[model samples]
Target chain A: MAGRKFFGHAEPREIVAFLTGGIFGSGLLVSGMIDTKKVQGWLDFFGAWDPTLAFVLGGAVLPMLFVWRIAEKRKVSVLGTPIPPRPAPKMDPALIAGSLMFGAGWGLAGLCPGPALASFAIGGWGGALFFLSMVSGMIVAPTVAGWLSSRTTS
Target chain B: MIPQDWIWGALGGLMIGGAAAIYLLVNGRIMGASGILGGLVDGTGRDSMVERLAFLFGTLAVPPLLVPLYHSVDTHITTNPGIIIAAGLLVGVGTRLANGCTSGHGVCGISRLAPRGLGSTALYLLGGAVTVFVFRHVLGVI
Candidate 1:
């Protein structure tokens, strides 16, 4: 309230967010990022690697770069919401370790969170299992961190 | 004729970026899927429940709708329950620990030229590439 401005009711903003998410989901579906074979293939650089994932990354990044540039000049969003804070640039252990673990998991399964969710429509029970397990992991992470910190302190 | 997958992949990427841009411009939020989900589950995002849920609802609902229109939403996920569970848990814990994932660090973070995003992206890619090499070439499990 003090630092940021809340425009109108959150309903409109929620609707907009939903619409944006729909587009994002559709894009992931269409781009083949949601497909495990394609994702695996892209990661298979030494084997029969497919370069499509790189293209998807490039394609997605190009436009957002412009948006970020515009964001730099503005204080509030187009809807008058306060601009979110930029994450600090520090490369702490958590960043590196978490990313490494995520990458290994991604390579092992050929599915990240986005594609994992998208796969729900088609991946059947396997998808459900992955989603459930991933959620469990997320729920447990903080506790794990706390435990680790306690162990280190003791 | 253009390769259908390439064309569609690029088109989809543009749409994803556009969606991210819209979320940023209109809602004043970063469209990181893991962050959104992680926060909601972890209780850190209580203040913005409506916003997060709305965005998630869109993401979850739209894909199923498109399944009828396009038969290309198929996924070739591994059938091994062990691998699937392991991967899921890793993604869950790893993303929360790292604070981002492909969408947050790979796409949105890189676009903003943030160091953490760049570093996370590079490390994950490296990690993925290495894992692939070991699994496919050495162990031949996948």
Candidate 2:
């Protein structure tokens, strides 16, 4: 049953996934994060700085703070799946370096993972190009990460 | 009146987190967008490919449908293929190496106040600010 496809299930696993995805989808659309210029404006602290993203971050975090508490106390989810409590997150070189790398990319184009996907609805060459390139980049990431890990360890 | 951008953004933010909460409570999975895509594409989550693909499909499908409501989903990304490719590659590589992104680390991790999540989020925020200063302010090239 756990191995069942999303739609294939009689249970609500896939339906929940779809509904959440819709929330995330419309959230981006509503928030105007799909607007690359606005995203850039949020990053443009030195220029005409737009503080909308700060609010977005703050608003997004508020609910999740409560969600984490509820999640932490739960043994199983409402859908009857195991809810694993997260441990103390470890600080490592990869975390430092990778975060910086991702930030640079995000600032460069003002497109993060969620916005990029949401923007796919626009049906533009720019969106298609970026999405494909990002996917291709993800495909090779493990190899790059593996090499980085080996190099750092050695 | 409060700026529409902030109002809409906050409302959307609440929705985003609300959706994530649903995913957490109902699906028992962290609602990190990059991790979902990265896991599936990278084959690390091949076993859950069904679920991941379904999530991807839903998110991707729902946005276009909202066009009737929101009118347009303009992303305003740069047309320069060079910039697009470079940015895409960097995002992919960086997120995978660090193991999270804005949704994962920024929203999910920071909300929980986890060390790695907090640390990564700080570093990326700094990285983004510095990059914007150098590229947008200094070079004037996006």
Candidate 3:
């Protein structure tokens, strides 16, 4: 039942998602596109800017489109299991609230989850701090949000 | 070893990707960095504590070992540690509120063509655009 709901009860959706993310991350690296400096510089458009980042994203995406097409045509689960695509979200308050918070954080830190994790390799106090706080945030926010949701629902 | 500049970005992405793959293959998990780190601190997932800690440390440490191979990147960041921490906290909040981060939703979820990921990634992009505008333009951080 659960399988059918999310991925057609055939293939393990988690495996598919994991491989998808792995390939995507690999794509980021191959393109030299995961660099926060590159990402930040791209964000710094109009001043000291390098717009090559868009090309990187495009390059990564174009290949992904082909992969998706092949996967769809085969209709065989990525892991030989039936999988249904997960549901998309509606434009609601959660998106609004989340987007605002994410934007504020990313704009300031210039370190989203991907680049922040990547930062750890550089042996900087900055990466350590970012990871620590990000971990903390991960632990704390969910519990607090869950509590808040319970209260609201109740 | 490797060249400078690309060390952190390349090594980090590979390690993270490798970990994600292992988790999926072994535990049937997606290996979202945020989710793993969160599970580590809060014990949200069913994995044993030792495994979780190992996973967390592996995620955090492997990349640093490769530092000798890469050069430093010149990105603009405030020297203020306080601001960086605060920003991380806010991102954490945002991830929880959104139910996933870029890896979880943007890469993993979107790759699966999940609808939630599509909506979430769109918002994430928009939010990123708006924040950059505010910081670099309105606030003139640059």
Candidate that scores best on TM-score: 2
What is the descending TM-score order?
A: 2, 1, 3
lDDT of 3 by residue, A1-154 (tens): 4334334432334434434444434434444444555665656655566555455433333333444445456544434533234354465455556656765677677777755654455526776787678777777776666765776656
Q: Assess the local accuracy of residue B131 in candidate 1 as a C-alpha lDDT between 0 and 100.
A: 88
Query: Where does candidate 1 stray beyond 4 Å?
Result: A1-10, A147-154
Against the native chain B, each candidate's TM-score is 0.96, 0.95, 0.77
- Better model by lDDT: candidate 1 vs candidate 2: 1
Query: What TM-score would you report for chain A in candidate 2?
Result: 0.90
Score candidate 1 by DockQ: 0.69
All candidates: DockQ: 0.69, 0.76, 0.26
Per-residue CA lDDT of model 2 for B13-80, tens digit only, reads 99888988898888988888899999988889877676776777777888888787765557888978
Give lDDT tens digits, candidate 2, residues A1-154: 4445443553467777777888898898888888888888998889999999888888899999998898888868998888757766678777888899999988988898888887787849988888888888789888887887898888
Assess the local accuracy of residue A135 in candidate 2 as a C-alpha lDDT between 0 and 100. 87
Model 3 misplaced regions, further than 4 Å: A1-35, A44-49, A52-92, A121-123, A143-154, B1-27, B48-55, B71-76
